[model samples]
Target: MEANLTPQQLWDCALRLLSRRDHSRRELAQKLRQRQFDPEWIEQALDRLEQQHWLADSRFAAVQVRQHVLKRHGPLRIRAELQRKGVGPAEIAQALAAEDPDWFELARLCYRARFGPDERLDMKERARRMRYLQARGFAPDHIRYALESADE
Candidate 1:
């Protein structure tokens, strides 16, 4: 089933995928391979896309970061997700640093939204809230401030 696609067909499929959303080079390659495209032809298609400036890891990472931030996800989760999508470490660092989101504020907002305004929580309740924020990928310090402070 995979071997029937000509190079043009494979290239067209790649473009269709990119048309829907940005994809890192590795991600695009993986998608093509999954569709049963020939490995050699997939590489050629990727190289062509790269040369034409249609496929870029940096652009993909930037878009992913923006979307994740809008969804209220933390830096740790965004970084891990980008890495999972096969973005390189340097690009990941650059993409994360380029954005200037208030991580502490984000944590607070997420906590409040999830558990509501800070009532006088018992130790177990406080710990539970802390765990929730932590699972959302906030750092410990940010979680502490979110759980302990009354700053809205």
Candidate 2:
């Protein structure tokens, strides 16, 4: 891959990436780095983007949370994914609060979507459903709420 692009070219590359999707500043830096861009140039380019509000961690976090919620993922998984993308804790928390997803309701929806609504289950099936919700990143309490509410 050609990695000898000028600073102008590097800026353009960043723009092209942002045009496709919102990217956290760190994520954009990593992407540019993967293409073998100089670390210093990448940082400077990122700074320019951030100064201009073209790249924002908060915006990226918000977008990520919304997208994952639409995909029926739980908060724990969402938090981990955002951290991996280099979002700060404060931004992640603020984004989550801004979205304000009802965890229990979301858990129930995911549970129902996966296992169907309120079918009687043996111990084995019950354990399987719990595991499924757990894997989807719901808190233990949220999973319990989702499952228990089905009984009422």
Candidate 3:
């Protein structure tokens, strides 16, 4: 992949990547740069793609949020992940707002699935699970609610 790409070649490569899935402008730019396209070429190609509505950070953020939720991740973790992926704060907020109201329920389901239905973990065990969920980007309130509801 060391060959120099003409402007058209760069554009084609960008489209090939975008056609597979949405990508944040930053993500696409980084990918193009990694392919050794000139910085100027990468910028111009990205601009053209944006003009054609092919690359959209907001769309990428929304899809990422949905996918993370489906994978049993909480809002906190998803938001951080999206931010790290170069999603803007406003788009991240919108994505989080669009997430399911039953997100807490899903987390509870995931917890039960992982630890089994036995809610008899001692205080230390309970705290350890709580810490695990926390590190996974779940809010304390959501984790607490899930643990309590599961106990019931």
Candidate 4:
């Protein structure tokens, strides 16, 4: 179906979509395409939103990182998710770097919460926990630290 939306209508639709959640430019473009918006109009609308500071990959990455961290997700998982959401590598790097110190701490807390006290995990259990944490995007160093400093 052809989209009969005027530029203003498309802009409004974009804003409403953004209001529900922050979207990367590519994501927004895809959404507009799904809605059958003209490709050129979609690009124009994206540009307008960016000029207005309504759509920013950096901001989206930051908010996504904050949410994932609060949800106890590891950096690897966060980075993967951001990439899936179409955030650029540079923005992802910047966002991840900004959370470097606290990222490990968050992973540690999540590990403890999921696996219980460190002493409770045996070698097999430790390996299992490590795998789980790694899948969640935690680094090996952080996993090792959590295992080593696990409360008995």
Candidate 5:
């Protein structure tokens, strides 16, 4: 169990996890905790990783934002996801800004992909599409634009 493991082993495990992919300190800590690593040891390992520039919330946020954007997820979903991952507000804002996705266009693309660009929807169907885009985390304005101009 944890008694048999040393701090060095925890550190190595942290590095091994990081070598596979970057992780936010909180995420990394949670992972270590799941393995029943000592809380103190986890803190020290996280501090060392931060000091060595190996684990960074900001970097994790950036990668997350890029990946979500590619999946056509909007700002609301992306921000919520970063928050869930324990990314700071400043880092989330910075990463979103860095990506600078054209949310309107992205919404339009999603809408077009779901319903053909030239297709006309009945009132109920239009409402349904609106809800779909809203659930996809688009802003009200962006969803409006997407519906109105998806064909154009």
Candidate 6:
């Protein structure tokens, strides 16, 4: 509710949100504001959480990168998503670098899973497949390797 909230209640709400999943400080702040919590109270609650080490942008970014990679999303899409979540570029870069899954292999797997046997495709068919991979956020080199080098 957007009604009056004691500091404790605000902190409880933030803890509840964090219990479900990691959230950037900005995301937690935005959610509290949306609930009509007083801005000062929101800031206080966030600061307390940070002091308790219950909130961390770096941890949030790391989890996001791993999750997106597992979903077959490429680095570009993952980086953009992290940025949208208010993660700093340095944290995003560190998270991405840490995860560093074999992107080329991932692209190949995604291509195989989506298109099945890489039958000798005509130029038009190849182009269409290439478009699909690109939309999935794969780099051009990875896409080319997947389409050309994947077993027929």
Best by lDDT: 2
Model 6 misplaced regions, further than 4 Å: 1-3
Q: What is the TM-score of each candidate against the true structure?
A: 0.93, 0.95, 0.91, 0.89, 0.95, 0.91
Model 5 Cα lDDT, one tens digit per residue, 104-123: 99999998888885676688
Q: After superposition, how far is residue 23 of candidate 2 from its true place, in Å?
A: 0.6
Per-residue lDDT value at 107 in model 5: 96
Off by over 4 Å in 5: none
For residue 115, what is the lDDT in candidate 2? Answer: 71
Error of 5 at 79 (Å): 0.1
Q: What lDDT, from 0 to 1, does candidate 3 have?
A: 0.84
Model 4, position 142: C-alpha lDDT score:
79
**Clash number for each model:** 0, 0, 0, 2, 0, 0
Instruction: Please give the TM-score that candidate 2 achieves against the real structure.
Output: 0.95
- Range of the 10 consecutive residues with the lowest summed lDDT in candidate 6: 1-10
The sequence of per-residue lDDT tens digits that candidate 2 reaches over residues 1-152 is 46567889889899999999999888899899897777899999999899999999999999999999998889999999999999999999999999999999999999888877686779998998999998888999999999998877
Stretches of model 4 off by over 4 angstroms after superposition: none
**lDDT, candidate 6, 1-152, per-residue tens:** 45566777787889999999999999999998887788998988888888888999999999999999888987777888888889999999999999989989899988888888866778898899889888888889989888876754
Deviation of model 4 at 9, angstroms: 2.4
Write candidate 1's Cα lDDT for 1-152 as tens digits: 55567888898999999999999998999999898888998998898898998999998998998888888888888988999999999988888888868998898888878877666778897788878877777889888887766434
